[model samples]
Target: MDTHIYTADDLDAAAKDIVEGKLVSFPTETVYGLGADATNEDAVKKVYAAKGRPSDNPLIVHVDSEEMVEEYAMPLSDEAKSLIKTFWPGPLTIIFNLKDNVLSKTVTGGLDTAAFRNPNNDLTLSLIKKAGVPIVGPSANTSGKPSPTIAMHVYHDLKGKIAGILDDGECQFGVESTVLDMSTDQPAILRPGAISAEQIQEVIHKPVLDERVHVADAQVPKAPGMKYKHYAPSAQVYIVDSPKDFEEAAKWAAEQDDKVGVMATDAVLNNLHFSNNVESFSLGSDVLSASHSLFAGLRHFDNESDVKSILAQGFSNDGIGEAYMNRLNKSAGQKHFNK
Candidate 1:
């Protein structure tokens, strides 16, 4: 299939494709999401096939309003009500028990519960409202690769495989939404993202279970990125834990047989002098900027075939830093700098 990028002026056409059960990639505040009408099983299966995503990993249902949630899901809890009031139309995905035979097994991964969110992007909300159906959305990229924050990144991975890309430029958060399971008595966080657990706890007046710990098990994941290896670039990534480690890491990279790439903050890059073979991408000034640049930087080096190793920066896992490190650690395969 030839993929055409649809602009804001042409969103009705994009919605038309989605309504007809064709795969369309759309923008979200978090990342670009591959969209298909959740009511259409064939459309949902094509999403898994296009991205090579495992069938058991469920997709998030993106909708335009809370009424849409009530239409398909079981009654929402008091806490779920509070959370939606606080963080709806943003980067928080909540899991709710499904009404019998409401959504396809292909969309929910055969689970009784489904994850749902309303992204803050206006283009996406308009598209969902225009299509007049809830859409199942996973990140728009090949499975196990960095999530696409820009529309071109989606094109690079899924050009001919999908119908069209709803291009609204670079994503704001540059990461996926936090997946929270509210089906249980206590809310559990399935995946960490821009919305921290502490933020969720404050809104609900309760502690959120950090279930990011149970990810490596054999059980089927309740959400995407839980049971799969994600955000991995083609090159080997070594995470430098501290500014002190970068000096030694540079020396080590100088001795390597192939070219090296560096993903670091402006301060760290200014102080270090790498060999000519080393190419660098700035992670901006701090952790917030680092989160925004993480996937783009990794993709930057993927274009440079000569870069066999990437020495990337790491920050203290707090606030949004937790989400940043979670993706960085996966990309680096938990390998840290010691040289």
Candidate 2:
């Protein structure tokens, strides 16, 4: 298939692709999502094939409005309604009990529930409305690689594997949505993202279960990023837990035969004097900035031929920092600086 790149001027063609059962990646607040009509089984299957994603891992359905979500995944609790009102048209993805046979098994992974989101990007919102159906969207990169935060990243990983890509520039959140499973009586977060657990609790006025509960959650997962190897790059990534450890980490990186990549805040990157073998990507000035740039930094290292390892800086696991570490930990396989 010829992979066409779409811009704001050519969004109609992108929308048309989605309606015609073809794959077109669309931008969201979090990341570029591989879009297929959720109601079309064949179209939805193409997404899994394109990304090499596991069928059992499921996909998040992106809608233009609440009606689309309610139409397929219904019986929303009052809390669910509150969350939607507060965070929809943004990065939050909610899992609800699905109406039987409303969405294809390809979308729901044959589970009784489905994940849904109303993305914050204006171009994608227009595309969803134009397509006239919710779209099944997983990150537009190959399965188990860093999620594409830019359209070029999608084109790099998925060009020729899918139909086309809608270029809306960089994503705001630079990560995937917070996956909240409201399918059960006790609500729990299946994954962390820009939307923090504290924010969710603030909205619902109740203590909702967060990703910590998933350590003991052995049940079938209702969201993506669980039971799957995701966001890994070609280079082995290790987390440096303290700024003081940066020197040791740098020394270790310098000793490696192949060039090593370093991802850290401006404070660290600016002070570091690098050997010729070091490739550095900045994580901006703080944790919030780090969350916005983490995946891009991973992809940056992934694109470098000589990079064999990436030493990423760590942050306090609180607020949005928790979200940043969640993804970083996964990519690093929980490997930390022991030196």
Candidate 3:
């Protein structure tokens, strides 16, 4: 039960462990992933156990190159090919009909479809190449908690629970990858991330459907971050859209019997009034910075222990703001206050 942190220099050792079916946490451009050999059912089950993730929640398989996709999956549609041509080696995961015997059944949660992505990180690619097998992984944290953006974040949540961690530093994108389900007639985005739906639509020359746009309570989700109340901190989180509303919400929470915290951008932080009862954290000046700091901020406040509740300013779904809003909504569990 000893968990060690590995640097770039230790990648060979890490890859060796991974190939031998040891659970290793590695960094990707989007976030740190708790990886296991995709072809090994026991190794894949260890990933679910490490994260306390649901057995039914599918994992995303990461490959080193586009050609490897064909080895584990088959019957890729024209649309899936186009997306791979455009977004592979990036933060987009495309769902395909999984091939039999090549991948562990645990990876697909016993389903016929599997999600695939080729991360743009050199270390990750090198690890995959060295391992000589596809790696199926999920965010390196306990299920329902904020996703890990830095290697230490992985250690904080998963230390001793896994094999080893590759400390490649903070991830470029704080959010998880965009999960596109090509198994459907029309391509549907099961989750939003750095790659926006509009961007995908422009690439495909077809409208990309977002599952979040509609309310389908009865249907089960096909990807991670879909059916679960994810990215939550220990504190109760609420989103306030307007600056005026945020001020009111922050003040009200601070004055309550419980200790409170406020998460805001520089623009909104300067305008809000603070009391001894409330502690404030800056999400950043803009949406991009907010995206980078959102999860960390949530985790930071949680570490304080005294902060019982938090009020975060709602982000607009513009540009990378889409992913920012998605994480915030999940963290807050869709609780919002408007003026």
Q: lDDT of each structure?
A: 0.92, 0.88, 0.85
Give the 10-residue window scoring lowest on summed lDDT in candidate 3: 212-221
Which order, best to worst by lDDT?
A: 1, 2, 3
Candidate 1 vs candidate 2: which has greater lDDT?
A: 1
Error of 3 at 243 (Å): 1.8
Which lDDT tens digits does candidate 3 get at residues 1-339? Answer: 888898989999899889888999999988899999998888999998889988878899999987899897877777778888898889999988877767766888677889999998999999999999999979999899988988888888988898899889899978888988887788888888889888899888888887765324554456887777889999989888866787678658766887788888888889867777888899888888888889888988876557888888777788788888888998998888643
Cα lDDT tens digits for candidate 2, 248-335: 8888877888988999999998887878899889999999999999999999888755688889999998978888888998999989
Write the number of the candidate with greater lDDT, choosing between 1 and 3: 1
Top candidate when judged by TM-score against the true structure: 1
Model 2 poorest ten-residue lDDT run: 211-220
TM-score of each: 0.98, 0.96, 0.95
Q: lDDT per residue, candidate 1, 168-254, as tens digits?
A: 999998878999999889789888898888889898898999888645566878888877778999989999999889999999988
Quote the positional error of residue 70 for candidate 3 in Å: 0.6
Scored by lDDT, the top model is: 1
Query: lDDT of model 1 at residue 239?
Result: 95
